[model samples]
Target: MKLTRRLFVGASAASAASLSAPMVMGQARPRVVVVGGGSGGATAARYIAKDSQGAIDVTLVEPSREYYTCYFSNLYLGGFRELDSLAHGYGTLASEYGINVVHDWAVGVDREARTVSLAGGATLPYDRLILSPGIDFVDGAVPGWDLSAQDVMPHAYKAGTQTALLKAQVQAMPEGGVFAMVAPPNPYRCPPGPYERVSMVAHMLKANNPTAKILIVDPKESFSKQGLFEEGWQKHYTGMIDRIGPDFGATNVEVRPDTMEVLIDGVAEKVDVCNVIPAQKAGRICELAGITDGNWAPVIPHTMQSRIDENIHVLGDASAQGDMPKSGFSANSQAKVAAMAVRGALTGSQVFPARFSNTCWSLIATDDGVKVGASYEATDEKIASVEGFVSQTGEDAALRKQTYEESIGWYNGIVADMFG
Candidate 1:
């Protein structure tokens, strides 16, 4: 189902007709505009398309022709998965799911008008809007690091061009050269992602260049799944990775791309490759729409609707929901509940009480895996943890295999649910 503009227009018109027919019969389906098409937005689109059964018109505004999953990206870097495997086309959303997928960046939201303005000069009017635009990196947090330096050092966090750039650098690096990774502080997207990426890169370096080194500069003293990752690095990469916590005098580093040098504690060092995952906040649209305060948009739990704007709902890594880590899985789960809430709001129906779940798997060494997850519920305007766990310590061979298998299963299910 490759959806061209013609197909999209036809589906949009058909959906509109279905919803409008109710008006002639003295009833009408509501309209919804989704501001993104990533994991969270896409899942919301899917559920809305299904649960509404053409009674809701959904328009998904996104800039990309395809959506990429960050879950299996580490495997893609480790030479175990291909880029296409993690990529998903929006054909299903446009054609089969009856979602109007628009390939344009949403620029503004007129809450009073109930409309979203896109960069392409399109104004989409909606009865309710669901926003899931992902996080944007905080520029200048590293003093000299900014968008101009992205060519030399890509965050690779968004899972497309940046991912390819980092992969090519690793493949082309000289033997035994240093690869520096600056991990972002907490309250960031995918807590275990950066470390898992380092582990996978180290896995590649071990087989290709045994003497190569990886320097992980961190501002925090502890990280998610730290103990498991450290043990796995010791057993597998064996001193190839140097862990630098804030205590290691790396707190005030500045990056200079012209010379490919990073100044750590006033001392400059050159590296063959650099992956700088900087601090992050809600995407700019959130702030522009008046939904965000400082870093993220405050939202009512269970509903995910903006506390300040009743007509708009925010989810994914963009919302300031307590007790929820910013992972793809969490985003996907929130999307479902958000879609339901948006529909209920627009149609004057009941918004069911919802609980959210998330699990993130980190590949520490080749074939070794670890994870952390939680189930959350809303209580008195705040989200509280229900149940979850970090991966068990002292893994058995059988458990390791099971974890790996479960990781793969999660990847497949999530991608399928998002695209199919």
Candidate 2:
């Protein structure tokens, strides 16, 4: 049978009625507390609540009232999307799916008691916990730069005011001024994100400040879709973007926000705007919960359960699941598998084997899109990639434009799946 949202809601209600017998016997309903309400956390909360038919009580703990997706913030920088278009509210999740949406910071977690402490001084107890706190920058990852200097050199990775700040900095650059980007190392959020931002920055400059130049100081010798990006840069914005790899001392770099100068291997260059994306690790709450292995939280591939605590699950960028790049699509996909597992564990629902998929689409210029994608299945050891595909160089413009359109459709669909 084709499962629609209405049908799922009905099924959930039926399940809840059947489970009422246990509640009448003095047993409590299963409780799930989700921390972070982005692609992973929101989807997990919605699915568990909607599919369980009120058999499970789900609480979502997020500090922000509105979430701005980091996925398409680069497009906002390029003027392809509006800032408001990237923002979403949790009202639908609460009103439609019967979720308890709490707007507060999740400050701590007590695994022993299965409770989450909030900044508002309330403690939420849960039978299962899902943590998808996203990415946080490492301290001292880039010398002379820290969170305090973010105003001067905006990371814009979290996608809100910082995104607007970076865009303003780029647009406000002097004629022929330099825009510098300090790219992060490997194992960061969105493997292709920094490069995509560079592309969008180039696109913006080409239209506004045609003479402006973009400099990339990258730690890695190579990057995701490097060939495709270079080809697009040369074709679309020739001589506009220059990259310095680690061989040229990209790894050993320091930023002086006070002076607007970046030191690359003892050589300093003054830039009109600096975008420093530092080395990243799992969000702070993971460390607080003692579930992370110093950087990222490890999880069982099939269930996305924490390796340290089976009752707590980790999803999205915070999870160190093998072979899956930390993308929103990956997080959303993992959330479904986790939701099913959590339901089965809590409500005696049927559990299915886990399968996952991801696609990362990046726009190089107007109507010029490229993509990389893969499908995976859970193995005894990890989430192994079964097959993959990438956009080839020299693809016709029609295909590229079609690819761009597909990405837009995906954005709408995924957000609906997450919020509703």
Candidate 3:
């Protein structure tokens, strides 16, 4: 249902009037402010606004006009999809859902005052604040490399221009040259991401520069879907890829972007292109709000409410909600739970026990895909996994193609769910 400002006030007045003190006292409509515009934030904003049916005022603060999903960005790098295909806009939320989409950076959060200060000098007041600001690289996570060197060695973890830059570099690699990736440690976004990227890069190189070599320096001893990734790498891009795990001094690594080189165990190897995915923390805004415990904001699994501050809710990679891997599917699932909680709190809507699920899919080669997924339930302490599944090592060829198709369908479904 499309709602104008007038309808928002009228439809919400009764519910807002009935709200208890300290929340919506004398307020015609309960205000919800959502920061960030990725999978988690966009889903929460759209769900709350659509489900509330004009009974709540929702404001979304995001600096970027076009949001690109980090989930399928690897497909873009591999030539399976275009970067533009991953982009979504906020026009529908503003026009159809009556959401106040503020294109500005939320720089500060005054929890005591219940206000968010935007970089554009506007303060957004809210009864409840939702923060899903994805991730920021940890300083010194990669020695001799920083944001200043991103132009030379792209992380491309956040997608968009960085993704395009990385792809361009890969395409321009000289024949038989090296493509090096310094993978992140444990508890990073998209557990299978770096490996999927390697697969994609290998896919491209196999077709364009057949003799090119791919190098991976990973800190973790074991990664998600290691067996499957290893199997596929061997089957499709054998002799073209090499991985240095923790046993091989992958933990002690550094990069020289200016010289286009990676040093492992004090031994430097020259490379044509480098993709350095550094250790990450919750976005800087979470730190500004004083809501982060260490690197992430802890949240109540049942409602996705911040453990540090009850009035705030944290979602996606920014929240240290247990068990669930940091992926787009996980964030989208958490958003539904948080949206229900926010609606129940502000508009007297029905609330149910939170159930979450996530599936991470990776394409190792054209029509050759693998996945790992799990169902989750909210416990007092955390979101615990209930059951899990993974694509088997010896799955049939047709099934792998089906799995890749499923991922494409998921991509379409999720973008529609998040934006529309």
Candidate 4:
């Protein structure tokens, strides 16, 4: 219905005639295969397919039929939103944008051949490949925390099975029971997520179990929106929340799932509910492809093209780009830049300089919210910040309410832009 100046300029500069008309006239199209249909992959697939206008064959490979976004998953836990509202289908990606949506996981990547091997045994060849498979948990980073133990201690970090598992456990907890959450170390997916989750779940507990308490065991001494979240927790939960940072003996905690207990500094405590968000790395697909080091794949800042393999680009939690946190907004923004770069590369054009934006919102209660954000631009060769942005800290009632409402609007607009 409307267009921003940036979008208009991007559209004009990336017209079909400018990028793909030659191939169409020659009766051939360059193939671009994208792995992972989350924020990064979906946005790139849609934009490139739309811009190419039949001159670029876009194939998207993902395992899930429907995507569940983690951005507002906390609202679902608080009973403020339905899960169906967060689930988006890829039909529009196929029918409207002409993207070939393949519901399958990519098991192997052949960089030499420029082909991606699917778990279903199908091979999709591409001139350029984009991978945004998200994060994978580092198993057993915390002693006694593993796959089977996840049944008793759900992470709920990845937003699918984990989300459902945690919700069920929270619903079953008795009134006045303890709900303990172990926040992961820094540089984890959705930096403000675990705190937001505690807030939403605490809201539910306050309504149904006024005596319930939330124990947050965090690896770091401080976190994003710490003051804002603490203020909201105090205002709404009446000090029912307790936070133990690393300095306060959080790192010394160990999980004992067999007994449904967590030990802080060797003092075992049983809880009715337990959620452990462990350390994470690039999703297994990147590891299988041998494109990542430690927990992330290194890539060029503006282009997002893999430094290990120039033809491949990685985004989302899977990439270790400088100074960028692993959040949905970051992934989505990087996807746009990566897509433009891919198109430019395919058509022998120059990649433009780009800026990116990210904002994370956390609800402290039904009508109160906290947030942090930043506007970033490329600096010479690295991604750097252009402005400082954060929500009002320390007990502002009206601003909190405004941020809560704004969070809803932001969620609606982001999902629509990605899937609609």
Candidate 5:
């Protein structure tokens, strides 16, 4: 394959004598323990395993055997894609790539010992650790909302059953009823996720319950692709959606799952379905690892290595890397960079300059898609955006449809790149 920044698996590598290796040369091979089986971790594990060619031992620790993609889940809610299509397994990585896939939760990390303790009473030692556990909701972010209340007012941000539950609740709503969403604050996973979800919800409601209303209680004043989403909402689902920003007291929001009511600025509003995407931080395991600065783990942009600990590398939404939006595309991009850096460190392989890129696609209405993307370079400070592009506000139907088609192709390509 051609050597691009995105696909650097087979690119530049120079062999070195065994004396140059980081770990003990004769006793065992250099071991890499990757936490989380999502975009960043999976891609990192696969790339390292494939590129290193058995020079390193790669063990991927993910609780779930079947991983789901949150990228195109909005399309699933809009009925454009099936749930099964978004699900992928670890069989290929385990069987074909010689990766030790452990279907268990990583509960603790011993940085000094370089060992990871799992929930299943297993201790795995490693020379390097990659953390891509994704985001977890901050406690008390939405008043009266927590993990327990998820059954009544589901935060379908994690995909899988939560996504299915939210979809079911929308389908079971009363005719002309309301569907409310509590949008998250800044620096959350998937910047345009909530808006795309609103568009998808509106798409479904317009067909089934035309009089159904969609309400957004957002803390942020403006969001990614605001113009594109607003224009699409007007053209596709006019009068069906309403947004309550900070100006309208959206910041002071609370939910009552027991009563199915959302208190927006102390005003109790009843809703048929509620998706409360609370404030997000790095996964809880990051706290266990003791590497987070505030809510997220800080990483050196060049290698995606945790600033607190050189052996640990943080990726995706859990990282406080600058500029890049917390999206699957961003995570995957970072994974390639991390994979290359990890291999070079462990096996004394040649390392190239770190380059990253990401694109986030949102389906507003049927065959109507909008996107924002950028190519980045690793600067001394952060991952700086070198170039960018976004979908035009007023594009022809053919162009919009083409963009939608492009998104589908991307979905296929990314999953293949990740799982395979």
Candidate 6:
């Protein structure tokens, strides 16, 4: 059924009213518990409930009531969007889709017992579990930086308040001050994210502090959309951005939060602002559940079922699925596949073949955008990419603008798809 906004609102109201209604005296519904209500979990919870038509009991455990999307957060930094525009609530999922949205952290999981323990001292029994806890930082990934030092140098990778803090710091930069970014290595969330962030920061600096400089210390020799990003930087914010790869001693880096000094290859340089994106691993809950292989949880690509436990499926950045970049699009796509499979297992619904696709669009400057994307299918070994396309180095202004507009449309469509 098509879920129009008006219909969704009405359905949600009805669901809310029915929350107090007594359950059937003898009916036994299969329960599915989902942890983390971001792109993956929320989508999975909605789909299972919507498709099952109340045949299955769906519960979503998320610590935060309001979710801020990591996608398009760079646009927020670039002044293309408002922070509030990125925030989403679970009311629709609760009232409209009949999902039990519990705003609490999932602290533990007992695989044998098939139950999830919440931080609020409640235990949810589940026939199936969906884990989509997203990315967590690796300890000491960046020297002299940890969670406590976030106030001095905001990563802003998680969106929400960190994004606002970074923007405020960028605006408050002194005349011709230096802004440094310690970019993450390969296999991180959103491959094009850090570069796009650099572009957004440059955009802000150009309008506010034209003479300010931007420095990127990257562990990887190359980054996503490298050619396009370099071209845009030179054209729009000339001589303002400099990126140092491993060859330039980018690998050996450290930061002093107190002095705002970044040490690159033993050379100490004081910066007015620092953004350090640390090495990432699966969310902490995955490790607590003993489903992770140190860094990430392994999954059978065809169904997103955890190799460790068939009853539990891991999606998005948490799963070590082959060849798929960790992005909101990837997560949403994986969620649908997992949802279908979960429904098939529980309610005997018809399961479709698993196919997936992802496209990452980035805004370089105002109305200037670029994207890279591919389609994939589940193979015996992995989810292998079949065909792909990327934005060229010398695209026309009209095409770039069109791409930017397309990104806006996608953002709206995706949020609706996930929330409604």
Best-performing candidate as measured by lDDT: 2
Candidate 2 lDDT over 119-166, as tens digits, reads 999999988999999999999999999999999999999999999999
> Backbone clash tally for model 4?
0
Query: lDDT of each prediction vs. the true structure?
Result: 0.84, 0.93, 0.93, 0.84, 0.91, 0.92
Instruction: Write model 3 residue lDDT over 337-381, tens digit each, in one string.
Output: 999999898867789999999999999999999999999999999
Write down the TM-score for model 1. Answer: 0.93
Question: Against the correct fold, how does model 3 do in TM-score?
Answer: 0.96
- Which residue pairs does candidate 5 place in steric collision? none
Residue 330 lDDT in model 2? 98
For candidate 2, the 10 contiguous residues with the lowest summed lDDT are 19-28
lDDT of 1 by residue, 120-147 (tens): 9989988778889999988777777887
Model 1 score (lDDT) = 0.84
Ranking of all predicted structures according to TM-score, beginning with the best and ending with the worst: 3, 2, 5, 6, 1, 4
Cα RMSD (Å) between model 5 and the true structure? 5.2
lDDT of 6 by residue, 219-335 (tens): 998999999999999999999999899998999999999999999999998999999999999999999999999999999988999998999999999999999999999999999
Clashes of each: 1, 1, 0, 0, 0, 2
lDDT of 3: 0.93
Each candidate structure's TM-score, on Cα atoms with residue i matched to residue i, is 0.93, 0.95, 0.96, 0.92, 0.95, 0.94
Q: How close is candidate 6 to the true structure, as a TM-score?
A: 0.94
